[model samples]
Every structure is written in C-alpha cells, then in structure tokens.
Target chain A: MTETNQAIQLNQVNYSITGELILKNITHSFPTGKITTLVGPSGAGKTTLFRLCNGLISRDSGEIFINGKSIDDYDPLVLRQTVGIALQSATMISGSIFDNLALPLTLKGEQLSEEDANKLLELVGLEKSLLYRNSKDLSGGQLQKVSIARTLVNEPSILLLDEITSSLDRVSQQDIEKLIKRINENYGTTIIWITHNLKQAYTIGDYTVVMMDGEVIESGPSDLLHNPKTNRTKKFVRGEIE
Target chain B: MNFLTLSLSLVFVFIPIVLSKVLKLELEKDTIIATVRSVVQLLAVGYVLKFVFDSENMIYILLMIILMIVAATHNARKKGTSIKGITWKLVVTFITIEVVTQTILLGFGIIPPTAQYLIPISGMMIGNSMVLSILFLNRFTAEIESNQDAIELILSLGGTPKQAIHTQLVNSIKASTIPTIESQKTIGLVQLPGMMSGQIIAGADPVQAVLFQLLILFLLLTTAVVSSALLGFLSYPSLFNERKQLLKKITTSTSDTEKS
Candidate 1:
C-alpha cells in the first residue's frame, strides 16, 4: 500500500494474442514481504499476468515497475532473476534432482555448494539423499517441491506461483502452503499466488485480489473472500457462480 | 552397361506393381508413376549433364549447383511449414553447406573444378544437407512445442534464449546426426554405396571407387553436423522475439501465425 513497501506495480497493463485481448487496463501493486493470492475462474488472465510480471512475455502496452524501477529499464534477464516464477506442472532438466535445483545458479556460471543444496532439499521437504537421484524418477509431489526449490536457488525478491498445488494431493498441497508461508515469514520474500481454491487462498494470503474476464473485480485484505465489496466478488466467493 | 541392359531394369518395377495388384495393396499406380518419373527425370538430367560437361563453362557449373541448392531448400522447407521465414531459413542453411563444402573441396585442391567432379559431389553434399535440415527442423519444432513450459521456466530463471533451448538444440542435433554416424560405421561390411557401385560397374578400379566413396561419405558426415547445428540456431530465434519473450507459436503454431 505504501510506496516504499511496494514490490511490484502495474499501470494500465494490457496484453493480447492474435487480436484477442487477454489482460486489459490492469492497475495494481503488491506489497513487499507479503502473500497476495489471486483468485479467479479459468481464463481470467491470472497466468498471463504472472508471465508478464517476470518478463516471460512482454506487455503490449503500459508500464511495469519492480522495486520502483521500470521493468524495461533493467535487463530482462536481471528482472527475471529478481522475479522468479514456478508453473503448475514441474518439468525437470534431464539430470539428477540436484542439477535441476542448481540450474538457476548454474546458468550464471555459479555452482551450488553441497551444503546449500542439501539445505534447500531439506527446506522443500525432500531428503538430502534425493539430490543424487535422477529427476525422471521423482513423483509429482517431489518434482513440484524440487521445482520450488529450484526457483528459490537464486534468492529472488518476488516469487510468482501459478497454481502449483492444483494437481497435488491434499497433503502435498498443505506442505507447499506451509513452505510458502514459512518463506514469507522467515525470509521476507514477496509472493504472488494464483489459485482457484478459495479456502487455500483465505488460509495463506495476507491480501486477496479477485479477477474476472481479464479485469480485476475486487482487491483488498484477506477477509475480502468473506466480506466482499462487490456483487461479482460475492457471487464468486460464495460459489454461486464459476 | 548399354541402354538396352539399363532399360531391362523395368522388370524390377513391374515386380513390385504386380505384387501390389495381387495383394490389394493399391500401390500399383504410385509404383508406375515413380518408375516413369525417374526414367524421364534421369534421362533429362543425363542429357543436361552431357551438354554442361561439353561446355565446361564455370557459369554453367555454378548455375547447376545453385539449382540443386534451391531444389533442396524447397524440399526441406516442407518439414517446418509452421515456422516463420522457414523457406528462407532453409535457403540460408542449404547455401551455407553447399558453399562451405565446395570451398573446402576446391580450396584444398581435393577435387578439380570441373563439371564432372563438381556436379556429382555438390549433388551429394546438397542432398545430404537437405535431409539433415529437414530432420533438424522436425525435431526442433516438436521439441519446442512439447517442452514449452520448460523453456519458459528457464527464461523466467534468468537464462538466455540460447540457454533456454539448449537441451532441445542438443537433442535435435544428436538425433539428426545419428543416421550419418551409424551408416558410416557400417559402410563397408553392411552395404555397397551408390557411387562406389556405379564406378565399379563402369569398369573403374575397385580401390579407386572405394576411395572416392570414402571421400563422399566424409563430406556427408561434415554436412550432417554443420546443417543440424546451423539450422537449429537459425530456427530457434523465431521461437522467441527480440524482447526475450516466448512467442505464442512456441506451444502451437497455425498457418496464420507462420508469418513474422
């Protein structure tokens, strides 16, 4: 909410593909060192917004600022390094799990120390011995956890997660939520999470933003799920409408 | 062999056509068409080669080489119809391979600058590079489509475009080059190649024919590696734009999006 505490800011951001507009005139800001959960129905542009935030896809028009600097001013690679993103499905590099985890550092010609690698493994709820195991042998939960660990290797300031827990079992989902909360609380990492599950969003988010048809419907405190300001948010949060 | 003996080889074509008719394979027309086309095409080429050899003009030789490269580019571009600028990309790749191979051969005095030597060897080089270009394009586009998220993930992690498609590029290069490697490994024991057998049938020494065939095979191996790597680099930038953003075509490309 305050200028100094803002981690990411979007001013009238718009994007499209093949003449079909995706995100339209979006304006919002995420506070640093807090969790902002994005809740919306399918095709509401949550994923596209995440891609824009990290420079995976450029915006058609409008400006994005990261930590008070225009995104285009920084090198695209440096901006991405500062803002890490993890997708729903985990795709491992063809190597041991350790290699996949260390890739972020490896691309910069840096190697992860054995101690740091094992520490990340334990942080993500995997055993250190799994480092040497082939990534192909990992289960879905294990792979997702490893993916999160991989994103964290660079110590990004802002982390964007796009429905990473949707495909996992309840236990794995809870484990991921806990890990995310721990990261925010302990490391002061700014987190933006997109999720369809209202309960999960209410449980972990310090702030919540609801979107519909490429436009933001309502954005406020976590209690916005229970005490929505608008009729569209009411219908969405009450499960009366998709 | 005389014209009569070569004409008798139509019996081989009849054998396949008759079998297809009897087995209800429905390939008789295709077999007949292939035989007729090859007969017409080879005879035309034979006369053209004889005329070109008689002239011995450098212009004619270069024209023939350019024609071969253009034909090869057209054929190879079919495999990557979804890629933007694919036709020109194949043109660049094929021309580079032809020029490089010819420069090496002539620059080193390995082969004389005569139509007889230049035409056949350039044909082999262009043909081999064409196949390699096609193989690389097919594998590269498929890899880009299937592993799109992985590539975007790498980009989001601060990796460059080269770093993003590194795995797919390597895999494609390896896949395209393996055929050349495996065939060369068993060249002598498993099969007698076309040029060597043609020479032997024409009464050339066995050792001399083998040596020429070896030279062709070596040139083919070099073209295979160079074409795959060159095409991979040329085609990958289309997957991402100048802003380092992954284009929509990375996942699924339509004819509509094939234009830059």
Candidate 2:
C-alpha cells in the first residue's frame, strides 16, 4: 500500500537506551481508521513503539511518517494532540472528573464547560452526574473510562492504548471492548492497541501485528491469527512462545 | 563570654551523647562529630567575621557574602540533583534571594551598611533559603516519582511540559513554604528565637532584640517563597525534552532512560 493510505509508517526506525538497542530497524505500515492490535511477549517493545509514534520518545535513527507527513514535521504538542495515548495505569488527578476530562484544553489555556465535560462522560458510558464528583473516588473501571474520555477530549485521529483493560474484571473488559469498537466504528479513529490476550487480539483487531525481540514477526489480516504463515506467529497464537 | 565560659557549654553536648549511649541509639558518634564540627567551623567563621568587621572594607563584606552563598549552594544542590544544571540553579536562586533581601534591608535603611549588619543578615537569609531549597527539592522529586503516571497522562494529552508538571511544582512550593509560615505563627510563644535570645544575652535591650528578631523572621518568609518558587520554575523545564516528552528519569548527572 502507498503511504497515503497508511496512518503511520515507520521506516528503518531504531531506538536504544543505555547502549542497548530497544528497537532494531523496525519498519511497518499501520493502516488508517482500523483497529491494529500488537501482540507479543512482555519485553517486545510494544509500548516503546507507541511512545515513539506519539513523539513521547525520539527514534535513534529512522523516519516515521504520520498521514504521509514526516512525524518530525509536526510540532510535538500538536502531534500528541493529533495522536492521543492512554496507559493501563488509570491514574486520576486530585480533582473532579470534569477537571480530569477538561485537562487537555485546560493546559492550552482554554476552558471546558460543564456541558462539554458531561458530554465526554456520557460518551465514555459514565454518568453525567460523575462529572462533578472527585475523580479519586472512581472505581478502576470508571477510572479507565474517564481516562479514555480524557484522551478523546483532544479529538485525536489516532489512539494508542497500552493494555488499558489488563487489570479489569471480565465485565469491565468486555464493556471497554464494546466501547472501543463503538468508538472505532463511529469515529473511524485509527487505533493501535497493545494487548497480551490472544483472544482479545483476534477478536478486537481488524489487523494483527506480531512482534518478538523488537522486530515485527508478521502482520496480516486478523483472520490470519487462525493460520499464520510464520512459525513464530503460529507459536505466539498457540500460546507456546510467550 | 570568655573561652572558659564557651568551654563550659560543652556540658550540653555531653548530655545528648550520654543519653544516646544509654539508649543504644548509635547517634553518639554523629552527635560528637556534629559538636566538633560546629565548634571548629563557628570559631573559624567568628574570626573571619571579626577580621571583616575590623577591616570595614566593601570588598571584605562582599567576599564574606560570596562565601556564605557558596556554602549554601553546595549544601542545597544535592537535594535537587534530578534537576539539570542544579548547581547553577541553586546559585542563581541563592544570589537572587541575597540581592532581593539585602536590597530591601539596606535600601530601606532598616539595617546599617556595616559588615556587622550585612554579613550576619546575609548568612541568615542564604541559610534559610538553602533549607527551603532542600525541602522544596525533596518534596518535588517525591511528587514526581509518585505522580509519574499522572504527569505523562497530561503530556500524552498534548499538555506542555510546564502544564504536565504544574501540580507537582505547586504542591512542592506549598509544602516547603508552609513550615516557615506555621513556625512564625507561634514565634515568641513556642520558643525563644535564637537571634533574639542571643541579642538579649549580649546585653541588648529586650524590645530592641525582638525588633531585630522580627526583621529576620520577615526576611525568612521572603526566602521561603523566592527560593522554592524560583527553583521549581527553573527545574521543571529540564524534566521534558524538546518534543515535550517526559523523560522516564530526570537527573542532572545522567541522561534519562526511557521506560520500556
């Protein structure tokens, strides 16, 4: 596929820390407006890749294009605004839910009205009543919902989720999955979700990318999870490698 | 007091050392070292102060102030090692504190231009600012470590570096400054301030001693705010890179290692 169709393209991307290479010449094209799940073992550098994509960490030597434009061409702040990220550790600032949801705009010296905050809460499957409640009082599931809501406040074109449902109960996980699917269908937000659950990767992703030791093993249609071409991808799907 | 009188004061030191020994606290060694160091250092400073006073030269006064600042900066900089260029940051903050406090004190004719007034007041101001800086740095680093998730949350949401660290910075400033404010509330009631008691023991009138003590008390408030707020502002920018990425670790001595 051409660069025009790809939301993000990493070409010969390399990253290292403390003289140890974390990512070694990673190259891939992530299609726009699709759910792409990255699956791998614990130290696969999945989260680091997302950080690099969002410009939270710079690549050592490589080029990453966002929507056919060089990632470096965009201002870091604006790039982050364009590409929102949410971590699994759903921490809340010591304030009301409204404050947490409005934080992105607040940082930009703009005010988010109560009505708009309520809309975000509603969109996240949270009660509009929760808007004025102290965020620290939220349950784990509620916190994650609010975290996603906060990320959505920026109206990002691409969403990077780092194990957002890893610690939740079954019901919460399913609810989050449904919410995410609805978000993708409605908004067409290209999402790169990092998950360890094979079932989740197979079920939720339109495309599945397998990573091992900082290299892409295989990426194909999610249906390929049932019959992957590479032995590594098969072992990964069979729960033998991890 | 004469040398004999000063030597007699060692009895107070012995009391602490004896108590620690009886309690098996293992603080006796530390106490002894502290006592010895205080005696030697203070005596040296005393002689130096006497020389500066006797000389009555502007250069000597300035030299004494510089020495105080160097000592203060060295002592305070360790607490803020996570801040880049912390050595220079502390120096700038200390120098600014000294200038602002002294400018007001001398500018308003509240104190004399003599070394007697200038040296001691500068010592107290810089010393207090140093303590405040340590307190601020300690709390700031702790806040950042504990709130790393929250800070990155803000950054990933397109918040500026200053915006991302805003909550931690404000909390640190408040935490450091509160002790100064609270201690002043009880001032004379809670305990005799050292400066006031010293002036009284040296044959100054009680009212005059208190007035001087109030001046020092007021000066400390300024030191508390200026030292903490200025250091916080200067240190936060170093916590992020040009891409507005929150460094996984912020340290002055080494580059940050990103969280894999």
- Give per-residue CA lDDT, model 1, range B139-160, as digits (tens): 8888888787678778989999
Q: TM-score each candidate.
A: 0.94, 0.95
TM-score of chain A of each: 0.97, 0.96
For A112-172, candidate 2 gives per-residue lDDT tens digits of 9988888887778988878889987889999999999999989999999989999999999
Model 2, span B1-260: residue lDDT tens: 89999899999999998999999999998998999899899999999989989999999999988988899988988887777799999999999999999999889999989999999999999999999999999999988887877777787888788888998999999999999999999988989999999999999999999999999999999999999999999899888878887775663222332333
Instruction: List candidate 2 segments past 4 Å from native.
Output: B251-260
User: Could you give the interface RMSD of each candidate, to one decimal?
Assistant: 5.5, 2.3
lDDT tens per residue, model 1, A183-223: 88888999999998999999999999998888888998988
Q: Model 1 clash pairs?
A: none
Candidate chain B TM-scores, in order: 0.94, 0.95
DockQ of each: 0.50, 0.63
